[model samples]
Target: MTLIDDRAPASVARTIAGISNGELSGSTCAPELTEGPWAFDLGMPGYGPGASQGDLLPAGSAAQGELPERYRRASGEELSSWIASAKASLGSRVAVMGHFYQRDEVVQYADFVGDSFQLARAARELPDAEAIVFCGVHFMAETADILTGPSQAVILPNLAAGCSMADMADIDSVEECWAELEARFGTSPDESGRVPVTPVTYMNSSAALKAFCGEHGGIVCTSSNASTVLEWAFERGQRVLFFPDQHLGRNTAKAMGVPLSTMPLWNPAKAGGGLSGEALDASRVILWNGFCSVHKRFTVSQISAARAAHPGVRVIVHPECPMEVVDAADSAGSTDYIVKAIAAAPAGSVFAIGTEINLVQRLAADYPQHEIFCLDSVVCPCSTMYRIHPAYLAWVLEELVAGRVVNQISVPSRVAAGARVALERMLAARPDTTMAA
Candidate 1:
């Protein structure tokens, strides 16, 4: 029953929990000891002592306590067998969509696997499926719910799975920022007939913010089509207000020949985002003070080291990374682009990719002829995406088989109406051929 033995199952669980809760230092945890495929099954640890409940749960998350003992105590073999049986029982009535960042165990059960926008589109194609089980984060499920028909039910396997980056740009803070912009810009269209400002939210944002964009004259953008979305925005507005991720905005705008001076960071805590009226007026793209914690961990130093160690290595990174890292890499694009780049390379090519470890490892395994590795040595995955385990997946699927939709993620009619408008605009937006990156 002791939780410290190296070979014991309970000890492995304890180590995972400690690492998640920040109780046990990552340096102290042996990397080799944590190499198992089912290591994420221990579940994300509760926040350490004195941390508020809000810190542990994402905004809009349902009340989910411990997983039932039947699921928690099930062996990997049992869970896999159970999941396969459940899927066989459900048949075509249900379809599971997994993101690129999901664990191999959970991903193995997915009927379709791709990036967020691609998965959202996949949900749209399943018109006959009654239940769409989204094995990604909260916002992604929300997007799926918004895209699918009204009769279709969208379920998030683990209610606790949510994106930390999406939570950063809440509705209230965004509305407040809009008010300040209106005050400074006078709410009037320029001589060319475009408005003073247009809000552009990243795909990794809350549905409420998407609704905000829909209600206003704004639209949504993904990493692949952000530059195109921005071009569409500028045609109708004097300035753009990008949210939930500053790095993508900066790097994309910089590529379009917009200088750094024209792109200013908008700090929500400060009045007028800590910018003078003149500064705000001069800015073309006002980037919100939010970023992906996982992508933020990548640095220029890591890229330099990868190049130094492996000469002539083709370095590719995601746009979510900071400007410095994106600049240093040979090329920067979306998750879909990274996958395609690796797939198209020669068999003997070497690639050092800066993205989630799950995806990098999968690429390495898929393209065994190539030497592929992650830029960072640390074994860090997207903690939120890792929250969805096969145990939870089995639980939800079994519940559905029992005719109970336990963790359905439903966007209210009022919100869905507005959010759909922005999403539709995104679907229609065609990115410029030269600006794919």
Candidate 2:
């Protein structure tokens, strides 16, 4: 097992703080990230701070209320001590799962730290826990709610922490797209017994979208299992309509030898997905018009820059990046893939990673024997993931210790039932040892 040093060199949070105080000389993707997330809670309904700060939130999106003044004004040492005491008090009653993109301030308190899907899966291992405090984005908490037992209350440290890419594909838009596709190609299966279209939603989406896939003959896929899920879809459907993250769908399909001509981008803002009738008929994979703000920052030029700086540098990026970036890199896969690659590499190897700044920085610090740096020098992290401040973690954990479940995320039973079908399908389709490359 690879152990990431909890005491890894300066975290993103500390760097941002240092930069804001003029003690550090580096550019942050968003200066707004320097403020506490609560600062945006009342201004407008938006993704608070970080990389996704520029991305617009959907209409009628819920806004978080002001955090208590005590938490906001608490000192770092005070918050850390409070969190430790709360965790010690709660003991086995609660399990905290953190995502790789989360800032180290919050991540250090996590009992289990990994990607969203991996963290949700980890919830299963703590069946006796009364509550799961997920220090990730909203979708991640929803996922844990779906996967864990009903008794395990899944709590999100910050209610405003939401994935912008996931917000791009809503249940209404997906249903509309499905209706259009169904009208174009009726419900009849071909003689080969494959449905006309299979809805495939990335794990980053809302629970409602996962439920939609279950209600339909669709399935759910994580970044690690996207290829396997797509293969499963192809076996049962003539074509696939992948949603929430277009880059993941497109890159995965293209890697599977699906021609670009057969994969069309679906724009929900326009009627009929803004594609011609001929285009729809020819489509094998219909990708939604969505992308991760953080991942989208990476460009081919970054690869060239890294290569120029270090002659034998190995480049690796997450599949959520645009196809061009993935193609330009030495390899592309999930967060786990990048971690495993570094763990397996020679001590003298140089690596340039294209992903969130938090994970890249953590990885670089964890393996000091190798030279690891982020392809994009800008200190941009997943905006939503960055919302989880240590203050919020301390507050939530203290609440849990008091027998109160603050910021608890509970998916509706109806939605969870449908989403479970798709999630179980994803687990079943996962290969024994192989993962997406």
Q: Over all chains combined, what TM-score does candidate 1 have?
A: 0.88
User: What residue runs in model 2 are displaced by over 4 Å at the alpha carbon?
Assistant: 1-9, 431-436
Q: For residues 356-413, what per-residue lDDT tens digits would candidate 1 score against the true structure?
A: 7678877887788999988876656676676677778888899989998878999998
lDDT of 2 by residue, 66-183 (tens): 8898988887777878989999999999988888888877788889988765775797677899999998888888888898898889998888888899999999999999999999
TM-score of each: 0.88, 0.96
Q: Which candidate comes out best when scored by lDDT?
A: 2
Query: Which regions of candidate 1 are displaced past 4 Å?
Result: 1-63, 431-436
lDDT of each: 0.79, 0.86
lDDT at 108 for candidate 1? 73
- Residue 230 of model 1: what lDDT? 92
